[model samples]
Target: MPSAPIKAMIMAAGRGERMRPLTDNTPKPLLKVRGKPLIDWHAEALARGGFTDLVVNTAWLGEQIENHFGQQSQTPPSIAYSREGLDFGGALETAGGIARALPLLGDVFWLLAGDVFVPGFEFTQAAVDRFAAGGKLAHLWLVPNPAHNPKGDFGLGADGLALNLPKDSAEPRFTYSTIGLYRRELFEAMPFGNPQGLKAPLAPLLRAAMDNGRVSAQLYPGPWTDVGTPARLDELNQASTTY
Candidate 1:
């Protein structure tokens, strides 16, 4: 079967509390890595991959994001914003924000965190075709555990299924790269306007899919950094000079 057209969502709504003082005024995504805003790197990657429609959700210091990108420009994807009000404050966690922006995302889309810096991964047309044909709820990019996140997020079997880490497993783990494609069905029961996190709601669904041989993941080997703190930001900035 032919795959549906692709669109992407950049999750940029976090308050970046750990990145405080800096984030006290500028949103994490708006902060510069090297010389460009953090979100610019991902936006350029998406556009290069031929994804045109992009949705970016914002809350803390959102006006900056809107002002910097405006409606759309020639160099980046045509961007749209799903503004989360201050009354709710902070972000709507990953799942809730996706749920709230379903209309913009439609049935399927790619989800990526705004704060992470990666040296671009291989997103082949074959993979996109497989995702569109399989009808799986989500497909994630997994990387070998980095020093900063040793415990890791999900466990992958030889069969390509991604299982939630067992409570007692002591083996090496693979960290989620904060990038993936998601189908709308995964958020059918997720509630909006609350402090719900993505893990609690999506883990079970991912686990069940893994057990049933549905969920899939691709092991990515490349430079990946989560610039959540000042230290990591500095590290990525230094690393960016060479890349």
Candidate 2:
């Protein structure tokens, strides 16, 4: 088995524009997917996979998140927070959020978007081992593009590296599942010390690194859903009850 990451982070700072009303009072990560918080699914899975420490970035009703998980305890991995807007106004976005949390993360850590609902995707030790040995800065899991995002994020090359290409090009593009293993150095260029929040997207950083062949990727065949809107959330809630 490959060595497991010592620390990890879950991106829970989105405003949930499409998940309004439900998110009006609650942060999206705190919203239940099948009787459990979306972030809990990731926390439970990471703990089961031997990850002991977790950092969660929050904004847009972040207090609920900190109050819920901070006041209580989760096993295996003790939980912590990287608040983006206590002094600031809104979220720092993905790259900025991760950069702010860099101090809390280790050299290599696990990262996942808090809102994605992916059932049965395991953080295997073998994948960890493969990444530890590969010397790549990032290891991503790409899934088939969902209807909402027919044009995917990156393409997987024959050499097992991630390639950024236009969806209409000959390369096969897959949607970014928002689950990945990343290195701290990748966010070195992003500012972190400001309380006002460093705002930026994560794609550009990944794309720049891909050009140097520093990112690796693999296709994941599993039940994955990006619960962006209320309609999708209702569908998942209905589907999950059957099982």
Candidate 3:
């Protein structure tokens, strides 16, 4: 049987309070990195990965996001928007946002953060085949912890399951790379319109899946930066130029 087409959702509705001034007028995803809008890199990456349908949720000066890339006919993956009006303020955290966009997200799709900068990482046909065969609810990309987040996010065991790190354990924790493939069923029970983030809903499901050996995680050695603050954004810009 032919594998299901890969779809993608770029989460881009945050006010970017940490990246003030620069985001005062423009949304964080619209912020320039290496002279290009941050989201542009993600859009191009997804298209290159063979994703044809793209859904982006926007708020907080969302008009700019729509104006620039709303109808990007030139891009391989056609882009669409799920506009959350000003009354909604900004992003509905993460899980809530995904829940709100379920109509557009099909069965299994990649969910990526808008501000993170990741280059040259594309989904492989073999990987997609494995994902389809395993019937897994989600597959995540984990990276080594950075200086800003030394504690990291989760633990990857030898069995390829993602386990929550012990609060008192001193072992190195692996950080979530903000790139993941998820099944819509995982978020089926989540309540929408609330600001609950992805963690609240995903953590339990991940833990359950880990116990049952359903979740899969891969180590990503490529360059990945969480461009949340101005300092990190500047660092990414500098790195792009120097390297």
Candidate 2: how many backbone clashes? 0
Model 2 agreement with the true structure over 1-243: per-residue lDDT tens digits: 436467879999889999998999999998888888888888888877877588988889998987777666533357778888674677888888888888888888899999999868887666777677778989999999999988899999999899988768887799999999888778777665434476889999999999999999999998899989999988998884432
- The TM-score values for the models, in the order shown, are 0.88, 0.93, 0.88
Ranking by lDDT: 2, 3, 1
State, as a TM-score between 0 and 1, how close model 3 is to the true structure.
0.88
| Root-mean-square deviation of Cα positions for candidate 3 versus the true structure, in angstroms | 2.9
Whole-model lDDT values for every prediction: 0.77, 0.84, 0.77
TM-score of structure candidate 1: 0.88
Instruction: Give the distance in Å from residue 160's predicted Cα in candidate 2 to where it truly belongs.
Output: 0.9
Tens-digit lDDT track of model 3 for 1-243:
767667789989888999999999999999988888888899877766677688988888888988787466674457777766453555666776777777777777888899888876786655766776777788899998888888887778787777666756776568888898888877767754334333233466666766666678889998889998999998887773432
Error of 2 at 181 (Å): 0.5
Estimate candidate 3's alpha-carbon lDDT, on a 0 to 1 scale: 0.77
Which segments of model 2 are wrong by more than 4 Å? Answer: 1-4, 71-76, 192-196, 240-243
